[model samples]
Target: MRTSGRRIVFLVGLQGVAWLLPAGTIIQQEEREPGTSKVKAQATISIDAGKLRMEQEKPGEGKSVMIFDQSKQVVWMIEPAKNSYMELTAAQVQQMGGQMQQAMKQMEAELANMPPEQRKMVEQMMKQRMPAPQAEKEVTVREKGQGEKVGPYTCIHYEVLTSGKLTREVWTAPMDQTHLGGAEFKTFQALGEFFGKLSGQAPKGTWELSGMNQMQGFPVRVLEYEGPRATSEWMLVKAEQRSLDASLFTLPAGLKKSSMEGMSRE
Candidate 1:
């Protein structure tokens, strides 16, 4: 789950073209729970044109790796401990979206039969997970006319609003500074769209969601809120541009790929 620190040194040879070679970028991020100063998880993200890999480690959850290959239009979720991987295609994600919608309907039906007090409690809890499907609302982003120095980069601050309520705040650095090109940014957006559909969750102004399109840069720090309470914070820790091998995006030979059905059964 780690990106190699090996650097591809540039040589000013006769052609002087070695310095022009494309380089992959690596970013480190730390996550914290709401109202807590202690970090709860850490993630390393590697970005190359048309591809991305993220490795996240959280307390008690071990490490998980996710790779998105734009060329194949598939995402691979790898479990190193099991030496296995799962591929999620657009069709599979769409099918899962339908399944989630059906489950939401079932939950709503059951909620109607619960005691009024219990229903209120449950509904309050569900707000943080999934918004009610019927409550359609557009997410909005606004520039706050402020900036922050996060890590080595200076970032513009912005706010995300859902139905006129503050839902998230973000600080972003320009794509040039983040070493993100058009293809890489597009792939990143696609990942957001896929996860949004798979989870049946409304967009909350993240870099991967609709609102981020208005933000004009890559997110460096993001703070998510539930009503008036800060729920989570993700801040960039480091970014490095270096050469990455194509094999980094490929699955290991001889490992079995698990199906969605097999995953659910487990």
Candidate 2:
């Protein structure tokens, strides 16, 4: 089934904000289309010490949980409806990267033996089918101004530019004012660095893990765009600094562990 463009933008907004979330806080965020008050998607994030859990729900995409354990350097993606979970570790990610490199080497060897004309044609087809590597763009962040109210907090407005074009507009409040712990904020920074290695291992229909290597403070509101057109808006609906249950960071008992090999086959 094909996914509509609107739904795709909604998912991107949800996941992008997840990367911006601070630890030791429970946050509820809603994503909406640019000109309307109607919510298109929403997510809840819980962060404690070095553990983080996010629950997200979409219209047709059901709910899923993502847990990142900094102590173990592992990430678990749970599908409640399927009664199963997928685990990713740093070592496993390294092994997969090695395998991909070997596969590329094999393909290159096969292409070398082909006729010049055939090789050119096959190369063109490969370029069309495979996504080319994206060059990293220079990202610059500038404070737009100060004292903007978002939800219950007054925030500082900032703009993020990529290659000199506006990419994201963000409003943030100081972590101290939000009453969230600063230790977890540092832990989340480490989490971002860790998951930066496992680039594409998250569930297909769910969120992708990304790092918040740039910009700081608790994000109160975020606006994402493509070129000049705004795509989606995310607002912090609720933020609480309270003790969360330990079980919220753990997988359910008796749940089957899904293997990466098995997942690839599907």
- Best candidate (score: TM-score): 1
TM-score for predicted model 1 compared with the true structure: 0.79
Local accuracy of candidate 1 as per-residue lDDT tens digits, 143-220: 986567877778898999988889888888988888777877887787776666654342222335447778878998
Report how far residue 160 has shifted in candidate 2, in Å.
Answer: 1.1
Each candidate: how many clashes? 0, 0
lDDT of prediction 2: 0.71
**Residue 79, model 1: Cα distance from true site in angstroms:** 1.2
lDDT against true structure, model 1? 0.76
Off by over 4 Å in 1: 1-15, 33-37, 102-129, 132-135, 199-210, 261-266
Inter-residue clash pairs, candidate 1: none
